[model samples]
Target: MKLIIAGATGFVAQELIRQSLRHPDIKSVVALARRPVAAPPGAGADGSKLKSVVVKDYDDYPEEVRRELAGADACIWTVAITPSKSKRLPFEEVTRVCQTSTLAALEALHEAGVGRPFRFLYMSGTAAERDQSKTPSWMPEYSLLRGETENRVLAFAAAHSTPSASAPPDFSACVAKAGLITHSYASSLFALGLRLAMGVPSVRLEEVAAAMLQQVTTAHGFEKEPLQNEDLVRIGRRALGEGRA
Candidate 1:
């Protein structure tokens, strides 16, 4: 399968790319990023199995870049900063970059003749929900905006399908709502404490990527809720073993 990994240089995106290279079912990977990715050590300068599509900015991708998306079976969109880091840029900018750019890219795909059955897996946060209106005051705006984006993307996915001509427009989308904890020192420590004290859940990065990929490749109905970490672990393990995601 031909896959596209958006935000290829991101910590999570990098892991997904590395893993995708090892999957026998994956034929080629298109790594879309603002800057070119350095080939993995031992891989050629051209990145042999990977194609890096560099854009000046996520908000403005050129037509040629859009064309590169043709024939892609799936897209793993892993862009967007955490709420805490979003403050580094204006909230309006963050919202546009995170939400608007996503819409633009999908539209680009359609205009570039990408068939509709294409699966889009968005990396969403756990608290991104229609009912999450009362998150901490400090980040209410960001939370609500993300929630809105999630709703919009889900709606769009439900209306489209791949190889547009062969199937009615019925694109599929899944949101991998990762946990507060990640496979990092700080996050791991916090997850350990939370598990022992507050029963908070955490997941491995590999598991999260695995589950997200499965959601896209399979024909399961659209998922309406944020997938919890434990759910991801289960689905991920199943997916890694070539079972239904």
Candidate 2:
């Protein structure tokens, strides 16, 4: 399968790129980044499967860029400014990076004319509010904005859903609502405490990447959208086990 990974320099994207190279089913991986992406550690043997596409801006995809993205089977969109990171920039800039860029990429891909049943896995957060009307006290505005973005993605999926069995499914999208991501064993204790005390979810960075790769590589369609932390954990664990086989 041919896969496209946006924001390839990010932590999760790097993991996805690494795993895609190792996966026997994945034939090619397109790493879309603002700058050239280096091969992940241990990728020396499988470097031929990976290609890096550098773009000047996330929002703009010229014809040359589109040509590289053409015929992709799936895309994992990891581009976004996190809430904590958003505080450093103006709200407008944050919205542009977090939301506008997503829509732009979708447009570019559509224009590029990727294959039918194109799967798009968006990297969202657990705190994202689906109901934009009900504003929570904690980072309400930002959460709502993200929720709206998620809704837009879902709507896109709905519009592209196959109308009949005879017709091919044009596009499919799923959102991975990941929780607090921790990398070290020392942080596992804190993650567990947070999950038990506050009912918040946490997942390892590898788990998220594994789950996403599994989703795209499957021959069957995704059964669920907006995969929660537990869902990710389960899928990821299964994926990791499969990788070892």
Most accurate candidate by TM-score: 2
Name the 10 consecutive residues with the lowest summed lDDT in model 1.
Answer: 38-47
- Name the runs in model 1 displaced over 4 angstroms: 39-47, 132-138, 161-169, 195-200, 219-226, 240-245
lDDT by residue (tens digit), candidate 1, 49-124: 7989998877686878988888888888988878888888898888887799888777776666654467777887
Query: In lDDT terms, how accurate is model 2?
Result: 0.87
> lDDT for every model?
0.74, 0.87
How many residue pairs in model 1 have overlapping backbones? 11
TM-score of each: 0.83, 0.94
* Model 2 quality (TM-score): 0.94
Tens digit of lDDT per residue, candidate 2, span 1-245?
Answer: 88999999998898888888888888889999999997898655578989899999899999999999999999999999988888888999989988898989988998898877799999999989989779877788888888899999878767866676764456989899999887888778888999899888898888888998998878786748879889999999988987621
Instruction: Write down the RMSD of all candidates, one decimal each.
Output: 3.8, 1.7
